[model samples]
Target: MGRKNAGIKTVCENRKARHDYFIHETYEAGIALQGTEVKSLRAGRANLKDSYASIQNGEIFVENLHISPYDQGNIFNHDPLRRRKLLMHKAEIVKLFAKTREKGFTLVPLKIYFKQGRAKMEIALASGKHNYDKRQDLHEKAAKREIERALKDRQRY
Candidate 1:
């Protein structure tokens, strides 16, 4: 059966996260945002390039997340790079805590989107990739592209 709430509107995505880390699992968590922050997110004025999530004192918080201030908010605008709390179940938090404690594992924000009028973040359990791994991935991608180009040229002839 199809999902009941499938109309997710993506606000921002961290494409570099996939390239820099090996993502193991993903979880959806709600964000605690202020009024102006919500308005700015709705306008798609957000960046997740260098954002990351961390568990602190039994609660999860996202840091370095940039939700630009609302243009019309005047002095009531929220800080662009303020830390925000993330809402997840207690059981889920415990599980994440255990996993993140392992060596080289971390919580990374993959994307931020609106689901059924509420903003949610897609966070992943990831481990950083080595420099050689990144080079290998780029080489493979280039080889795949060259193969596709050759096939297309042969078909044209």
Candidate 2:
């Protein structure tokens, strides 16, 4: 039988990133991973929390991304918090760098997943959300939940 759910398998997601930033654009970039790192990722041991992308010396790199070491790896385990290079087109890098230079705009990794056996990261160009903006989003979400609850109750009756 064919493998079930053979599409993209998500390894980890940064939920906090969504709550903290207003994402304007997203880009898919390949990660330069070591052998142990790839093994650990395939085992679903990775975290995107507090991880962010930045332009450094004309290249893009992700920092603070924690990829747990492979349990079976003896002496070649990669560092959990090493800065990893992200592979993207030169033009895309230039655009992203320009946007990040603007006040309050930053680059954050939204998620990490595997596609066609290759690891990929979804990075977004985003702006920080103000406290009031966060509160407003929460209020709107609660309102939508309430409306949905009311509709379900009406159908039940």
**Candidate 1 Cα errors over 4 Å, as ranges:** 1-5
TM-score of 2: 0.95
Best by TM-score: 2
Residue lDDT tens for model 2, 1-157:
5776476899999999989999999999999999999999999999998899999988999999999999999999988999999999999999999999999999999999998899999999999999999999999999999999999999998
Give the C-alpha lDDT of model 1: 0.95
Candidate 1 Cα deviation (angstroms), residue 138: 0.3
Each candidate: what lDDT? 0.95, 0.95
Candidate 1 worst ten-residue window by lDDT: 1-10
lDDT of 1 by residue, 17-124 (tens): 999999999999999999999999999999998898999888999999999989999989988999999999989999999999999999999999999899999999
Task: Pick the lDDT winner.
Answer: 1
